[model samples]
Target: MAQAITAERGQWYKRLDLDENFEVVAIDRDEECIEIQYYSGEIEEIDEASWELLEIAPIAPPDNWSGAFGSDNRVEFEAQADSLETALNMVDNSN
Candidate 1:
């Protein structure tokens, strides 16, 4: 019997039966299919039926999202700089 849980994009889930963690990357309702990326960088396409067949539980995102990528791929994401007016507006001159 399929579980009541249905896969949704951007959600993390653990497959209890296989002890594997996967993230739902994309869903195509028109195609009735789902794309999942495993912790080991493996991408698999499964139909909705197959998704429900798995014993999965919703889980918090893993501590390290770079499980699939190598050290070379690890890079810090920098915040974009604000506009000149925005930056000037935040200056403190209450001395």
Candidate 2:
């Protein structure tokens, strides 16, 4: 059965029974087709008949201890800053 879907611009969706995620880049309601961009930078048009509305779970930021660093090394920099702050605080307390 074709799932009933309402495509909205800038919404993320996943294919039924698939792990890949896509964002709705455009919608042509008059033609009943939606343009989607994949996580891999691939873009394609899918007829409304082939897709359904997907409920995506909210993603949480990585905890400080987690090793999942971003491309800019933000996590490592934050860790170093925190350590330096702690050491400076200890020195200040000892004085």
Q: Which stretches of candidate 1 lie over 4 Å from their true place?
A: 69-95
**By summed lDDT, which 10 consecutive residues of candidate 2 come out lowest?**
61-70
User: Per-residue lDDT for 5-38 in model 2, tens only?
Assistant: 5666645556644576666666788998888766
lDDT of 1 at 15: 85
Against the unseen true structure, what C-alpha lDDT does each candidate score? 0.68, 0.54
Q: Count the clashes in each prediction.
A: 0, 0
Best by lDDT: 1
Candidate 1 has its poorest 10 consecutive residues by lDDT at: 86-95
The alpha-carbon lDDT assigned to residue 90 of candidate 1 equals 31
lDDT of 1 by residue, 1-95 (tens): 74779787667889898899988767899999999988888889999878778889999767665465333423321122143222222321211
Using Cα atoms with residue i matched to residue i, what is each candidate's TM-score against the true structure? 0.70, 0.48
TM-score for candidate 1: 0.70
Distance (Å) between predicted and true CA of 81, model 1?
14
